[model samples]
Target: MNLKKIILSRTDAIGDVILTLPLTAYLKKVFPETEIIFLGKDYTKDIIENCPFVDSFISWDAIEKNAVSEFQKINADAILHIFPKSQIAKAASKAGIPIRVGTSHRAYHWNTCNRIISFSRKRSDMHEAQLNFQLLKGLDINYIPELEEFKDINLIEPKQELREDLKEILNNGKFNLILHPGSKGSAREWGVDRFAELIKLLPKSKIQIFITGTKKEGLLFRKDLVVPFPDVVDLTGLLSLKDLMLFIKNCDGIVAESTGPLHIGSVLGIHAIGIYPPIRPMHPGRWAPIGKKTKVFVKEKKCSDCRKSGRCKCMREIASIEVADYITAL
Candidate 1:
């Protein structure tokens, strides 16, 4: 296919958008002359624009306000819906894009999309990044890239400089680590008690720790986690998304659940240690950070008792001593 312009639509959360970045890298490799426009939410604009492979970014909000006009102005040859959105699919069809790619599972795609690829995200054993490549089948690209191939792909380039106050917090002599204890209800958390225990176990003299999250999360854990540890720096609610990315780039590593910042740390080639449950779909096997230095701590056994609840006893059971030892070794 001799395509000139392609819009990669993934209007989703941070981690989902991060995983979809590899698709742009693959697209660039196959179609060197083709322009890649990433259609994403406003919150993810920084991430998409910073990607070296992405040529431009279109705001999904704008598309929602005026789908046909917004898409018509793009004049794209194709649009791949990496994260399926019904309205976006309908808009792409209404705009008459030459090749509209989406999943066959979506009944709406039968009418809206010209090219539909058949696959089940929940049933597939592939990693999130690997599964993203399956959507490329719509473009006549049959390759499903291996997880190892992602190690070589340079996805994020943090352009913003770290703030002066944040820069001063970095210790050149020690490993500057970020401990994100909350997931904002996205993934099952590793529990504040466990994180507090992990902090106490770490060698404070050899490691500089910083706790990061939204202001709400900060207030929620401040009393139990931050107040107890006077040495730990509190950066909650202080960082914008761009600041967080730049900050993660400067840090040595991060420990969190399957969240955006963890993925950022991984893509930046830092030691990103993720804590996860053994539950299906949410397990590390499916959503693990894609980086050369990433590590995952999950229970060996599979149990779905907590599948319906937000809390996971299995994830909390991962010992603080084990995670501390790995960080210390790094």
Candidate 2:
């Protein structure tokens, strides 16, 4: 196929978009001359902006808002649909992109695309990264090693002011330990009482603790506060996603619930300890950190709150001393 311009679409949340970045890196590395375009949501743009692989980026919703006019403007040779939807398929069809490739589920139709491949819905069986990798098969790109997939994208350094601010907080040359207590939804949190107890236990430790998350996480952060804990700092709702990355990279280790920051810490090669409940569907090989230094602390329970209910039972079982011990050992 003499494809010069390519549109890769996957308009999803932050973690979903991060997993798909390897796909972008793979495409760009193999076809260096190819003009790579990413079609995603607004927030996705921020997540992928630093990716050296993408030639140009566009938001699918922005195009949907002005379908006809936008379609005429983006004249591409092929469209790679990561998130296959009727609206996206319809727009790609109307744009008259010569080739179209995407998943067959959701909104399947003759008008959808000529190269539609079926995507599995089974949660436990498939890794999100591997699912995105499946799209490569359609483009004649063979399977590559997991670690080699990401072409070394340059590291984005945090702003000087932010770095200085963080440095001041760390008076001594102490190792920073980041704690992300709350996940995006209510289903993932390990609870505030447990975190508060943990903080109280780590007073004299050499580890400097820092907490961060979105504005919604402020409620949980306040609840997790201890009366007197030396070198404990809270920056919840203060940093941007990029700033969060810098903060994590600067930290010696990370202890977080299964969320975006955990994934970020894994990618940064920081020692990350993920706290998750032991459930049937949860597979370490699939969801656990790809880095060797990363460890997953799963508390096995009969119910395991994660199997049927999304709430984590194992996290509650893990004691404050256990978590503190793990960090000290690392």
lDDT (tens digit, per residue) of candidate 1 on 101-181: 999999999999999999999988999999988888889989988898998788998777889998998999999999999
Tell me the deviation in Å of residue 10 in model 2: 1.9
Please state the error at residue 170 of candidate 2 in Å: 3.8
Question: How many residue pairs clash in each candidate at the backbone level?
Answer: 0, 0
| Residue 324, candidate 1: C-alpha displacement in angstroms | 0.5
Model number with the top lDDT: 1
Instruction: Give model 2's clash tally.
Output: 0
Q: What tens digits encode model 2's per-residue C-alpha lDDT throughout 52-159?
A: 677788877677777546755777787777876678778778777778887666565356687766666355355566667776767776574555333244322233
- After superposition on all C-alphas, the RMSD of every candidate to the true structure, in Å, is 0.8, 3.2
lDDT of 1 at 134: 88
